[model samples]
Target chain A: MANMIDLIEKSEVTGDFPKFQIGDTLRVFFKIKEGDKERVQVFEGVLIGERGGSNKRAITVRKISFSHGVERMFPLASPRIEKIEIAQTGYVRRAKLYYLRDLRGKKARIRERQDYKKGKDLSTAQVNAAK
Target chain B: MTMGIMATKLGMTQIFIEEGVRVPVTVLKMDPNFVVSKKTMEKDGYTALQLGFGQIRAKLVNKPTKGHFQKANVEPTRFLSEFRVDEKELANYEIGAQIGLEFFEGVLSLDIAGVSKGKGFAGVMKRHNFAGFPASHGTHETFRHGGSIGMRAQPGKVLKGKRMAGHMGDELVTMKNLRVIRIMAEENLILVRGAVPGSKGKVVEIKVSTRKPKALPGVGGATLEEASKNPMKASKAGAKGAGGKKK
Candidate 1:
């Protein structure tokens, strides 16, 4: 399993991905191609969960549209992703913010995480950081 | 036309093509291989080329294997495999001549042959996929049994090669017509679509298919030419000054 991750990391492309966490709100700029044309589509949502490591890493984003909850899972290393903007950071106890799905309106709101600002933005640095 | 090479199964991964289509591929590391011997119809009653792959330590080479490599003036290899090729193409190859992933260039589909992972001693249900007896309702200890072997009194013993519990896997399995998704020639790595017949690190013999790849249009000679044109030249050039190995 670890070897699989190592193999993935070797092939995964590392771009300037934004630093965000579960329960945080993000605007993911995804590249969508149309008939002989390509455009960037912005998907704003609350980060529900994140799984896998390095190249195989993926994030689940959930957003409410017309009172209906919609969730989309995006691979972090996918080339279709143009950029990700961390609009707001949310304070979360659990790694996966799946419980947010059940809550509506006021209850769904996540507290803003203040501690994240104190640390230097690590994701911005182009260094070989492995987890 | 019998184009094949010996490679080690590096593992499996997914590559995103145009339009975010994730193609699952098994990466095979094709170590440098050399033609050890060629069997001609006049000499050996067959037209085949015996290729040696992976470097083996001189001490690890047996007496017979050492003699074989000595005769060819090449280093001992870990694995030796034979593939049938056309007699006319046999002249293109020479004794001790090297081959690698280059042979697989433009090969859209390939036949992967390897020893599947051994599943030890298994029962009929797991090994043969036999639907066992009911789990509940007085079916005690007969849960995983193969049930009735044959009709009453008709044939006393079990039929030969009957699907029964025994050793499973650890056998030579060939997965044919797998699409060749990517070829990293610098690393000697080949990415083939779909699952191969072996576990990670297993030695797999990859050969060009005589049959056409299913449903894939324009997968003939042109694809192989495109693959040979060094698609990864830009990527390899970027890493040259860093003193890093491609693999």
Candidate 2:
């Protein structure tokens, strides 16, 4: 039998998004509604963390603005999100890039994954796809 | 009052509605809820509907339980509960009629009652939210104590119903004015906005809230919490007259 909670959450997930890991840089196109007009805003940042489950999945993105760190969280299943484009793939030892908040300038750079083209991170990609 | 239904707590999850706002919702699975019997004002001195839910095998039921289902001509149910209703409202239901999720259609809020998770033999700090003695101070084992129970002399018998340590939780608790987020009739599920008392699979009583039904937190206007925080805004919102006393 299908899990009732899963069935209910599945109804809210309307889009098919490509898999991206924590260290990857993501370019998010979010819809902003102002008065009677709606416009798309682009936010490019490194994926810091991911949380929640099923249709409630969310991602934390971190970027430097005016030399100050700014982080924003977005629900992956939200309809307001136009699309999430994978800007660049990276390799990191930890699941969260929260430690990068303390580092600045050249020290905060992420190492690009050499085998990203080959999809060597297929294992984590498969797990996220299942969710 | 309207009739209440019985449902199982299916834990909690979040959903993103319009505008990308996230709402934490509790999923309640309502099985086939049948009207087992009715109590009339003339016979039982009060009007109420006895509801039965959660089907169980006949062999598992005792003789009296089996006979009760036999009297109603309904299948054996694992749980039976009563929802007191106004004398006039009692006319809406008949014995053995099944109540579905549609009953909550257009309802804004609800009152959910269930047994809260038990925390055996808890101290005042844990049970009553009492601040314990400072750990750095000379306080020893009395950290979790309830402190002074009574005065030195006058009327000093540890006054009745004083806050003290005892059994905590595992009792019938009613959470009122819980916003009704979404209702899925096809799946027999009602998604309530916020937490419901009890652990997953615990049986709960669901009914319309007795409180003056305010405009659900963020359906259209400002949320109740936000309104209360700004009296100037609340008064302005009050002029629009969203919620009124339950008549």
Candidate 3:
């Protein structure tokens, strides 16, 4: 089942993102359409959740905007995504960081992951099974 | 040439189309279909083409059927269905000539027929889509019952074809005007927009639709999917069904 979906959406996959796991702060450069014109918008937030496989893989990024919680989910391998910039990869445990939603002010801050490996690693473990 | 060919249903899956539109498509494996014989109007009183498809061992065929295949000079096919064609289009096909997925090129909509999965003898709720009595509120044995048949005195007897529960599915079913989303020529796989009759691995007859499909913007035509079931509609529906599936 996983192999069949991969073969079908293989062609749509383009531009791999950095290996930034959950709890990592990400700057997702997204392409938006305004009338007939197109522009890139950058969204900075903490990676809360990531699910699905191959071209269908999506990531949920949460950021507090104007004292209110805001979240945006984007398909990781979508053509609409121009690039993903890892602002600060956090060293955290759980697969999903939903608990961070309740915290506000200084309580929601994530510890900076000290072991920041240099150089861009092209090979990404993107063929994850849907959970 | 025949308006359509025989294929085995291979279940359903989702695939992406252009501009990232996810389309639900059913996979069908079709063998190379061939013309076994031609029924001429001068001899047979009607113009029809006998299409042979699917593989069968020579030893498995009975002596009579084996002899019939020998006359065609082609390998014995498991299924042989006759499809009527106009006298003019009949000239395009020759005995033993094969038809592939390319035959349906540029056709955006089609009809598929197959024997539906049998659900045995069912009750009124599942079989006929009857709204049975309420389950709660002290509903006794009449919960799943089929309410009432008819009133007393005047016409007391139950009306025929009243949509009552009886035999369900396992019947020859036809799904009309399914949009053709994609056609993988190399894989011989057609990705239709919606569901078709029957379960996985079941034999399905796919052809041009009799009614024009309004699902697509410009695609238009009609064809016969049940030529064998309704032989009387063969010539008329065959011509129309051909136009439906042809590019």
DockQ of each: 0.30, 0.29, 0.14
Q: State model 1's lDDT.
A: 0.74
For DockQ, the strongest prediction is 1
Candidate 2 ranges with C-alpha deviation above 4 Å: A116-131, B214-247
Against the true structure, candidate 3 has what lDDT?
0.71
Q: Please list all clashing residue pairs in model 1, or write none if there are none.
A: B106-B223, B106-B224
Q: By DockQ thresholds, what CAPRI class is model 2?
A: acceptable
Cα deviation of A78, candidate 1, in Å: 1.1
Instruction: Kindly provide the TM-score of model 2 when superposed on the true structure, using C-alpha atoms.
Output: 0.84
Model 3, runs deviating above 4 Å: A1-6, A9-15, A26-30, A42-46, A54-79, A82-85, A90-131, B210-247
lDDT per residue, candidate 1, A1-131, as tens digits? Answer: 23532554455544467667777788899988777799998988999899987667899999999999999998987768988877776777888887887899999998876634455323322211321
Worst 10 residues of 1 chain A by lDDT: A122-131
The local distance difference test score of model 2 is 0.77
Model 1 clashes, total count: 2
